[model samples]
Target: MSKGISGGCKCGAVRYRGELSDISSFRCYCRDCQQLTGTGHSEMFPLVAETFQLEGPSREYQMAGGSGQPTWSSFCSTCGSPLTRRSERMEHCLYVHASSLDEPEKHKPSRILYADAAQPWDKPNLDE
Candidate 1:
């Protein structure tokens, strides 16, 4: 059986539901990710196009990434919780923060990206 993912803003003003397949998760340690996640790494799950859908309007901001690609960061305008990131090269895909899932335990990062961009002080524990 395939169960979909459901989550929303802390204030419940924004809700989302989607069915994502071919899951691929990773932690990115680029400057943008560190700043956005407020941590050493930003965890995400690769989202296949057409598999994800937005139920309500989400606030989006344009930013630059380590990949030198235009990044669009989106979040709940009401609560300001980070929602997703869309990149130009990955237009067919959307990346959602794993922590944003209703059941975060079910989503785990599988790899690390931009390892060269990682700061000297940020050491992520990869062993589970």
Candidate 2:
């Protein structure tokens, strides 16, 4: 029963709301995340999939995940803002981009994933 959270795309064309899940937030340095965010990694937070609701114009792109399962990246069709990542391997939670939250500061990444795939220029902050 965590507090509810809400957010949307850059252009306000897409919006989502959900109750936070008990799952710890995480930072992912996987190549998919790197390419998606155009950064060293992506900040992600989990929401209870059963409580999640989305609205407005959005699109999704599917790709093979590190687990070799189908993963989908959702974005705002109008503003092209990255919104969420869903994997067939993890269906109970909807992973939302931390930056996409209405209060991005609320996101606190507790662990790092795919650190081995980190780039030299943007190494994972192990100290955090």
Candidate 3:
């Protein structure tokens, strides 16, 4: 197993930890991610649900994915910091915002998702 990581929300109302063995990270440019983050994309790292744990007050929001599956997002109710996201369609795994990790650099996305949805001006230098 890989070393564990921990992080919490801006207001300290929510916290999470995971003993990560593996992480599949991605940068998502889907409309849902764009609007939710108010940015061109959102970075995420998926972890096995069984190895993740959380504490403190959090609120959950549910929305339909492009695939018509329900996705649930959890955040700190007090500070509105995005914490975790999961989908019934992706059973057995929970996704954590890459930036929410204590050491964000540890989770570098391997690929981009919904790249077609990316705004032209927001595109990064892929050649790098």
Name the top TM-score candidate: 2
Clashes of each: 0, 0, 0
* Per-residue lDDT of candidate 2, residues 3-66 (tens digit): 7999999999899999898888899999999998888899999998999999999999999998
Residue ranges of candidate 3 with Cα displaced over 4 Å: 1-3, 21-23, 124-128
TM-score computed on alpha carbons, candidate 1: 0.86
lDDT preference between candidates 2 and 3, better one: 2
lDDT of each: 0.78, 0.91, 0.81
lDDT of 1 by residue, 1-128 (tens): 24577776667777766776575678888788888878888888766767787767679999776677798988988778888888897878788888787777887677888888888887765675
Give each prediction's root-mean-square deviation over alpha carbons: 2.0, 1.5, 1.9
What are the clashing pairs of model 3? none
What's the C-alpha lDDT at position 75 in model 3? 87
Model 3 per-residue lDDT at 66? 87
* Candidate 1 Cα RMSD after full superposition onto the native fold (Å): 2.0
Candidate 3: tens digits of C-alpha lDDT, residues 1-128: 24677787888778899765365678888888888777888888787788789999999999998889999988899898888889998878888887788888677677788988999968843333
Question: Candidate 2's error at 73, in angstroms?
Answer: 0.5
